[model samples]
Target chain A: MSIEIQNLSYTYDPKAKFKKIALKDVSLSVEDGDFLAIVGHTGSGKSTLVTHLNGLTKVQSGKIIVDGIDLTGKFDAKKLRSKVGMVFQYPEYQLFAETVQLDVAFGPKNLGLDEEEINVRVKDAIEAVGLDFEQIKDKSPFELSGGQMRRVAIAGVIAMRPEILVLDEPTAGLDPKGKRDIMELVLSLKNTLKTVKTVIMISHNMDEVARYCNKVALLKDGELVGVYTPAQLFEDDTVEKCGLKLPTTVRLARVLKARGLIENDCLLTEEEIVAEIAKGGRHA
Target chain B: MREISLGQYYPTGSLIHKLDPRTKLLITIAYIVMIFFIDTFVGFGLVFIGLMATVLISKIPVTKILKSLKAIIFLLVFTVLMTLLFYGGDKSEVVLSWWIFTFYKQQLIDCGLIACRLFFMVLGPTMLTFTTTPVQLTDGMQSLLKPLALIKVPVHLLAIIMSITLRFIPSLSEETDKIINAQKSRCADFESGNIFKRAKAMIPILIPLLTSSIRRAEELACAMDSRCFKDAKNRTRMNKLKFGWFDPVCLILFCALFFVVLWLKFNFLPFVDLTSLGWIV
Candidate 1:
């Protein structure tokens, strides 16, 4: 397993008047190179679990073995962080330096990389995020638009060269075009960056996640409700029960099936639905 | 990181919330001055009684008021300790004794008076903050400081900064928590380290948090610009401060309390005369 969580649990303000159990014995595993999409309602602890992978939240009563390193109050958290770089929801918030190049190079510098090596990593990371290395390198990140700032932030994490790239709602507050571009960029990075073996992301946009992620983990009230292939997981009714919506394609397929227009349950894509409709026409 | 409670205003139609924030602010300042001026138990009793009456009329939970005291517990204890160690009675004979320490009758009285002064200083203003929102506080400050603007004090700019700081505090705290957790998932332990190690570990969090804050500031600037928010431009307020019947009544009550405090401090109440008591020795 690229990442393994066993009976993990976490609570916040455990002794306060408003104590909360943010995670409740959630256990799951993701294989190397798995594009796992985590979905949940607000305050459902999806963010809590993914954060544990990098040691943001300590696992109170569980075992989180990520790439064979036990992250249970014993390991070097900073080294672990370098290994699994996280891109926050509003990635632009991570842009601290004046210039784009310096901002992108922050992670590499934190990793204690040499100046020459850090320069290469910054250039490669900028390129990996499909940002022009020369055109905007010297410009202040503050002067860039929202999309460019986000790219710079992502490149900052990419410069760390983590084995796993975890993102939390990376497309939040972005326009549709911006969202589409970010999703495509992540997919392209996965295709090109062989060392980036695992991509764990939390998103509420069910349709985009369904199209992009190979695996899906559903969380409800701090519990891992289910983990399955997107097709299988989306087919189940529990997703709706957990206050989450299914992908639009899955919803459309269900509607079509309910109308007696389709026979097969495996249709999840637009082209697949078209083929199924054509088959229905031929049979009729 | 929970949002700071300084801007936590429990909205109610009670007398305290209805009072003009400017009136409350002035009254708080005057009450604090009176607290320091009168140095006797009888004066403190009067202030305490007045504060209790205000609390009852405001209808705010006593628990919340007491909880606000939690933040200043250390200061309170330190003040008590200092009073015990430093003060001594001049006319009265010493009572209790320890190694190089003497407790006298007048020293105890002096300590009690100081404690009361500190208590009123903290409690009087806390009631104001808890009852009034940051927006109202800024508006009240702006109105009160209007004279300063003639001297190019930039009262409007100061108010804008205050409001923005109040507005972004919660947002930034939420972001900090998220970034901390994101770093934690990578196994970043903020707890269970020596001071140096802990400080070193915070670099990852601090770097990401600072970066994000700068970015947010830029985004906020853009958003403001797109909405045509220009510096030094007169803008209409969605909620304007106007003196209604409730405000006038509360203002009169506050004025009455201030005058009563002023009278009690200056005439009828005798100050403890601590300076002549040789308490400093």
Candidate 2:
């Protein structure tokens, strides 16, 4: 299923004196199977836009048809949420159940699933997040490490078997190894959960964006600056103009190309840069 | 929740906002005490004028200050109703009589006076909060009650707790919003169903909010401990409270107004004589 957003605009406390226009008139669409990266400077309406995709925030002045569900009026939020699972920033703080199994079962239980289906979904989801279900399912979620707690929180959302998975800075406040592991886990989640057809992530790490994301949607001042492929986004000066830093791989690739060290059209990842150099130096 | 501007700080950076919190605290206490001293209509009128002038000087929008009174609307109406209906007036001055309640000119005037008093009462506190941050407020309270420390009160600890409580108000409200939204995305129905169902729905929001709040408190304790908070008995504040030039001038002005109000209270004759009814000595 695809999502289409049309002319979305949101203002907080519209009648108050200090009303804030959060999102302006913007239009975009995401097709299924696309691993989309939403990158913007802080308060660029990335979170606001993603919240609307799952009916977390009400539609103030826009039309969002998320996976054939119109979120403009009295649509079923339960159905929409089951289609789009949101893993918020520092999601571990949202964990509250006594055991890891219970926490992972919270969403499916809310979906009104029966006992056997919930058990199956909970076990699958817990295992899908790379946690040992047999060993840690009965353990208190609070007793887990920070990264494990975060995984349990994500498992709670994944148990709903949503067709689309949305993450807002999934690796925030993590160590370097933890960060890599979580991103790789998200990649694995896409493979393990056939129901999850699309992944939308809001992140500041341009290296992760360059490495995993197929399409990048840049937002500036609540306005969409056209969706572009990872290669196309890094090929121009748009990322810099939007007050975002480039990935180290893309920067090195650009510097090498400028000095006539490599003859490559567009290089996004370190492996792409390495492969381009292996083909031969431009001076060679 | 952020949209509720009632009793929240409004940063206008006006002259009133610059006054020392201790001075503001003292003057607020005095103003509240003085509200009961004046019984005359003219005196209440003067108090109204004084409160409005201070509100104007605060640079807060007049409507925003009025908005704070919305919390006490029911009380205001009840007070006005009681004063109007229960006034025992002269046998000849009845303005309207309906059912068991009789309204008189004196009662109508008393109703107006009571409403004005209640209106200004809410406005006075609202003005303080709008002009002062919560940190400044607790600091002011701690400084004013420093004398209690000599009697073995845990003054510094009390102040720190109060300060943290104030600091967490906005953050906790923000976290509540996030948790509610997160639960809503999990197909948690917080708005529908019977009362029991709705109350039960709050579990998802409250548990996360409570846990995070406790976690934050623990983290803050650790951070404070690492910074040698235990040895902070002689700790100096960076934004030390000092009486600026406005403090003395303001004190004098307030004193003058207070004496004038006291003079008006004792010297003026009321329209109704409670002494004749033996309610006063």
Candidate 3:
């Protein structure tokens, strides 16, 4: 298992007049190399749950055993963080260094990595994000376009070389093309990097999750509604009751199936939906 | 994360809220002056009664005022102590003695008067904040200080800066909270280190915070520029503050009080005058 959360519960200001239950009795496990997508509305506790993965938030009354180690115990958290890199929402907002290279070097430098290793990692990270090294390496982060700066921010986290990469709304404000490019880069990294064992992301875009995520965790008002394979969760009638959208491809598949043009249960991606339609065309 | 309550500005419908901010500001100033003009304990007593009446009319909870008082308790204690130790009088005689410390009778009286005066000074004007929004206060201040532009000072710029900084306080606080959460996720323990270790631990938090602040500032500057901040030169007020008859009436009362205090300064009243007791020495 890449990550295992057992009987997890957390509350904010538990004894205060305005105590809030941010998380409750959520138990789940992620397999190695699994791509997990968590979906929830604002304040639904998705942020709180993801923060717990890297030990950002302590499990007040539950266990978060990551990579076979009990993270609930007090340990060298900084070292643990290096193994679980987090690229935050609006990451461009954190770019403060004078140049892109320096900003990307920040996390690695914080790890106390020597100059040679840091340089090698920065080069690989920049290249992996499809950014031209020489052109952008020395430019001030403020000087880049929004999408470019966002990618550079991602590269900064990537340079830290974590086995499990966690992204919080990585494409939040990007244009459609920018979003596609970022998603593609993420998929490529997951496919090629053997040591990159788990990828967890929080997103509201159902279509994006349906296309890429193998496992989905649905959170509602800080409680784990269900954890299931994407197909099982989407096909369940209760999903819409929680104010969630059916994935775009799944919706289309349902529409096609209703019109008697498709016979299979459902599809979760544009390609699968189209392939199913092509199969129907031969039958017609 | 919690100590920053912008200002009192208690949201309520009351006679104080109905008063023009300019009027409230003027009256608060006048009230402080009037408080100082009270010569004897009777006059001081009258001032206290008047302030209490105003507080009642404002309809603000007395507990709220007491909360403000609680914040300034240390300052109040220090002021009273200094008055007792330093103030002297001609007829001053030791009321109590403990080792090297002497409590002179005249000094005791001075201490009581000064402490009450300081309390009234804080309490009187605090009503302005408790009644008026910070925006109104800044607007009042800008209008009052408009003539200072004759000295080439950028009054408008100062107002914009004040308003923007006030607006960003809550925003920056929330941002700092998020960044702290982000760092903590990585096992950065902030709460359990020595002074030096804690300060060192803050580096990870501060770097991201400072970086984000600068980035946001730049974005804000860009947004302001696009919104024609360049034409910021001759911008008219969205809500101009107009002085009414109430404002002049309040100003006159304060001017009268100021003159009375000045008069008392030269022609001191015997009961309130500690000079005869040689308290000034």
Candidate 4:
């Protein structure tokens, strides 16, 4: 299954004096099992683009085809939403049920699944997000810690058993440890959950994008500059034109390469750069 | 969706905007009373001229003042229709006669007068809201109600609640918008449903909005406590409200207009009979 977007554009308050162009002529294809990271500066249409993936915002002008289902024409948006689960920024704010289990069961229940099936999905989804289902099931979601509440919120989306999981700044407002935990949970889902094949995440953290994402799409001023693999995106100069900083390890690798201390120009992680440094020393 | 401009203060350095909010409040009350006191067409004409002159002097756009009328347009029409249908007098002449529905010239005139009165009634307070900021209005309310504290009323708390409610309206609307979008992504269908189902669909959005609002209120309370925001009597304002020359001048002008309309209604227009003008039967 793949998501194909063609010439998607959106504008807020289109008829007002303070009209703003949020997205313009953006097109990209996300393949199955691809951990795609969308990186852009603030107001670069990253949030606007992610909202269109699951039919949250209507397509002003363009087309989106998800798994052979065309979203441009009259189609079941509710059915499309079931297939594409979206976790919004601060998803914890959307949790409303009296207990964590009930909150997590919301999506599955909305899908009209049987009660037994919803229960199974809710438990599994909570476990997938690394939350103990039995321990936190009866507790009010509002009483949980910020990190735990965010995990429960993500579990609520995961309970839908969607094929494409889209996250918009899932780790925003979290502590450093919380960020790492959330990212690892997402990474583990890709490896573990057969239902979630494609993961589309909008992130501002270049290091997280470099480490977890296989492909990166750079956007600037509502336009898609290019889509590249993590290594290629860091190695290319187009990333600079997009007004984005290179991941720390990639910048260090470029510096090492400039000093003639490293051979390869593309290095995404610190471990890779350290191995390259050791290899260069052995060669010397 | 940001075109909601009702009851929002227009910031401009004009005679009306510069008037002390206490004086503005009093003038608004006086204008409303005068609108009701007006009975003759000449009196209503004077009140209309006074309203137009205030609008001109306020330097606020005429369209904005007209926009405030849009909110009460339905009320105006309803009152006019009610008066037109139910007003009974010596029905010497009938304008239109139908089965159980009769229109008289006097009833039509009464409807027109009531419409004008209701129109001015809405416009008076709308002008007050347009010219004075919510903060100023609440401050004026607190100051005016300070005497009630002697009778054991919690004036300070009441003012704080009013200000807080006004302050959070826009923020709550923004939060509601966010929650709706978030829930919609979860396949929460809010549009297509029967009335009860549609209301049930709002549970997801409403619950989140409530939780967030409670969270915000708690945070604000904590922030206030940390900043030592208790004891409203000792709290000094950053922008103190002080009555200046403009306030008394505007107050006197409005009082004069009130008396002039009263005089016109009572004594000035005796020669012209309104029923003779084909407006009344």
Candidate 5:
């Protein structure tokens, strides 16, 4: 399913003396099977924009069409939420059931699925996130390690079988290894869960975005600066102008290009840069 | 959903804001006492004027002070309706009759007076909280309750608990918001479920909130232990609470106003009995 946002604006505490404009006339589109990474400084509407996709936030003055459902109209918000599964920052904190199976079954149960179907979905989701269903199914989610608990939480959302998955800072506050594990789990979701057609993630770690995401949307001061593919976004100076840093590999590629070593400016991964450097040596 | 402003401290450079919080606490208590002692309109009028003057002197916006009343509006209206409906005296006369209920003249007057009393009753403490920060209020509370140490009250511990409670309100609220958003994303229906289902649905939110709160408490205890915050007896404050010249003047002014209202309630004003109004006799 594709997602389209148009002319959206949001203000928190609109009547208060310290009203904050969290979003402004922002417009963007996500095509099917696109892994879009939204990057910006804090307080730049990245979270607010993602919330609008699933109807968690009421669209006061804008239009959002998710898989042809106009979100602003009197449509079924809960149904929209099921279609656009959202995994928030520290999602593990939201787990409350007695066992991993129960927690993972929470969403499908809410959907009023039959007992056999819920069990099937729960087992599939837990295994899809790379967890052993038989071992972890009966254990309390709280008993798991931080990374395991996070995977259980993601499995809970995965059980709902959403077409579009929106995650807000999924890897925040995790150790480096834990971050990589979570990112890998998310990257595998598109292939493992066939229903997941579009993935939109809000992330601060530029390296993760550069390494994984195909498309990147840049936002600043509640407005969309521009949307470009990862290579194009890293090459543009707008990333720096918006107080964002390029990924390490992209920055190294830039240095190599400036030194007349590499001809390409779009290298996004360490392996890609290394291969490019090896190619340059053979030509020289 | 951001309208929860009870116990909020408004920062304005006014005399009330600068006065010692202990003095403000005492004044607020004294003013509430005066509100109850007031029986006549003249006495209530005096207290009302005093309250308006204090609100003005505090320099906080009148609208903000009024906004605090929003929380108690239902109670205010209920009090007025109950007092009007149930209050009775042998000398009271019926002013209006509807169905099986009768409205009495004296009851109506008493209801109006009670409503005014309730309004000023809420306004007084709200003014104190508006002008004084929670830290200063708790400090002042600890100092004033120091006298209770002779009676083995654990004054310092009470103060610590109060401060911690105040500090956690905002954090807990922010955590609740985060949890709600997370659950909402998972298609957790909080709004449309039946009453039983809705209550059951709260499990997702309440469990997380309780666990996180416990985790925060544990961390706080550890941090306090690491910092050697063993007992409050040897603790020294960076900013000690002391009464300035303005504090005494403000206290005395409020005290004098209280006495004058008491005196008027007792001696001078001719009590115009509502039964004598002839609408009902």
Candidate 6:
């Protein structure tokens, strides 16, 4: 199912002195099974937009339809939440259960699943995030390392088996290895899990987005800049103009093309650039 | 959640905001004491005038100050209703007799008087908090409790703890909101449930909130330790508190109002006999 947003606008703390216009007239669409990346500067309405997908924020003045469910109408919140699961920034801070198994079981239990189903989902989720279910299931979540704690938290959300998984800065403060590990796990979820059909990630790392995301949605100062293919977005100066740095791969490809080394300078990922260079094509 | 106006400082750079926090604290005490000492409509009228003047001079919007009344309005109504329905006294005219409950004209006046007392009791301290920053209040508290420190009280440590708690209120609230939304997205139903179910639901929110708070407190402690924060004995403040000219003027005016209210309630103002108004039978 595709999610549609139309003319969405939001102001925080409305009718007060601290009111701020967080999102302004943003319209976007996400098809099923699409790896969509939302990129923006800080305080640029990225988080506000994703929170709407799960109906966490009430639609002040707009329309958001997810899988035929219209938000702002008399709709089932539990149904909507089960469809869209959100992992907030610093998600490790959300781990609070006695054991990792209990923590992972929290979401499935909330969904009112039976004891047997909860156990199965918890084990599957922990395994899906590349953790040994037997080793960590009975252990306390707090006793784990930082990266392990974060993985356990994500496993909690995954245990619910949401159709659309939205992550806000999933790998924000992790080490380099932890960052790659999370991205790999997310990609695995798309390919392996039958329940998770679409993935939406808000990220600041341009290289990570270029490698994983199929479509890129750009936002600037509470406004939607535009939506484009990752290659198309990197091909132009739009990212830089929007106050974001270019991906390392895109930066390298530009120099190689300028020096008559490759035919395409807008390649999205590092491996694609390497492949293009290996083909030994020169600009005529 | 945003209806609060108390304990939130509004910086307006007015003369009242510039007064020493110690002076403000003392004045608030004097004002609360005077409120309890007065029991006449004339005295309450004088108080209303004083509160209005204070609100005006602070440069905070009158609407914002009045917004704080919303928090205690339910309590006010409940107490007044109880008193109005069940008042027992030596002499009281029956205003309304419904079923087993009797409403008295005497209780009506009493409720009005007590409500005003409660209202001013809250507003006076609220005004002090709205003008003075939390750190200043903490410092003033520590200074006031200095005499108790001679008896082995940890006043300085208590001051630091108070200031830190005040500093973390906004951040912790923001964190709580985040956790609530996160759990909501996980299909955690916080709104619809029996009391036990609701309390059970809070486990998901509270455990995470508590853990995160502990983590944050540890980080804060480490940061403070690295900065050589040993004790408050040698710590110097950049902005020292000084009693300005308006402080003495405010004190004298408050004392004068206290005497005038006392006279109005007891000796009876010569120009107008309060009994003629029929407030007292």
Best by DockQ: 5
* lDDT tens per residue, model 6, A17-103: 777889999999999989999999988999999999998888999899999999977788888888898999988888878999998
Model 6 chain A is weakest, by summed lDDT over 10 consecutive residues, at A275-284
Across residues A1-284, which tens digit of lDDT does each residue of candidate 3 receive?
Answer: 47889989888888866778888898888888889998877788888888887777777998988877788888667777887888788877666677889878877876878999999989988888889998899999988988888888888878888899999987788888888888888888888766567899998888888888999999889888888788888886556777888888888878888888998746888889889999998888
Tens digit per residue, CA lDDT, model 2, B185-233: 7888877899999998788788889999998999999999898778435
- What digit string (tens of lDDT, one per residue) describes model 2 on residues A1-284? 99999999998779887878778998989998989999999988899999999987889997989878989999887888999999999999998877889878889999999999999999999889998999999999889999999999999999999999999999999998999999999998887779899999999999999989999999998889889998889887899999999888878877887787787746777788888887756347
lDDT of 3 by residue, B1-281 (tens): 33345777887787667667877776776676577665455456656666776788789999989898886789889989877767657445778899988777777777778778778878887878898988888878777778998998998898888888888888888888777765554345678768998897787667768877776789999999998786345778778777666566656655655665554456565566645645333
List where candidate 4 sits over 4 angstroms from the true fold.
A236-244, A251-266, A277-284, B1-23, B55-73, B80-109, B130-167, B227-250, B264-281
Better model by lDDT: candidate 2 vs candidate 5: 5
Query: Which model, 3 or 4, shows the larger DockQ?
Result: 4
Residues A1-284 of candidate 1 have per-residue lDDT tens digits of 38988999898878876778889988898998899999999999887787788876677898999888999868876678888889977877555566899878766775667999999999999989988899989998878988988998888888888889999998999888889899999988888987688899999998777788999898888888888888887777877898888777777777877888878755567677788888877766
User: Residue B54 CA error for candidate 6 (Å)?
Assistant: 2.7
Q: In model 1, how large is the Cα lDDT of residue B113?
A: 76
Interface RMSD of 2: 0.9
- TM per candidate: 0.70, 0.82, 0.74, 0.84, 0.85, 0.86
For B1-281, candidate 1 gives per-residue lDDT tens digits of 45356555776678778778888877777777767667667667777888898899899999989988887888878998998877645737777888988788787877777777787889988888888988798888877887998888987778888888878888878877766654554344568679998997787678767776776789999998998888743756777777767776765765676666566555544564434545332
lDDT of 6 by residue, B141-251 (tens): 777898988898877788788878977887788899999988887888888779998999899899989998898899999999999899876557777778889999888
Name model 5 segments beyond 4 Å from true.
Answer: A253-265, A280-284, B1-14, B36-42, B56-119, B149-157, B231-245, B261-281
The lDDT, on a scale of 0 to 1, for candidate 5 is 0.87
CA lDDT of every candidate: 0.80, 0.86, 0.79, 0.86, 0.87, 0.88
Instruction: Write candidate 5's Cα lDDT for A70-170 as tens digits.
Output: 99988887688889999988898899999999999999988889999999999999999999999999999999998899899999999999999989899
Two-way DockQ contest, 2 vs 5, winner: 5
Q: What's the C-alpha lDDT at position A129 in model 2?
A: 92
| Residues B173-200, model 4: lDDT tens digits | 9888788887877777788879999999
Candidate closer to the true structure by TM-score (higher is better), 2 or 6: 6
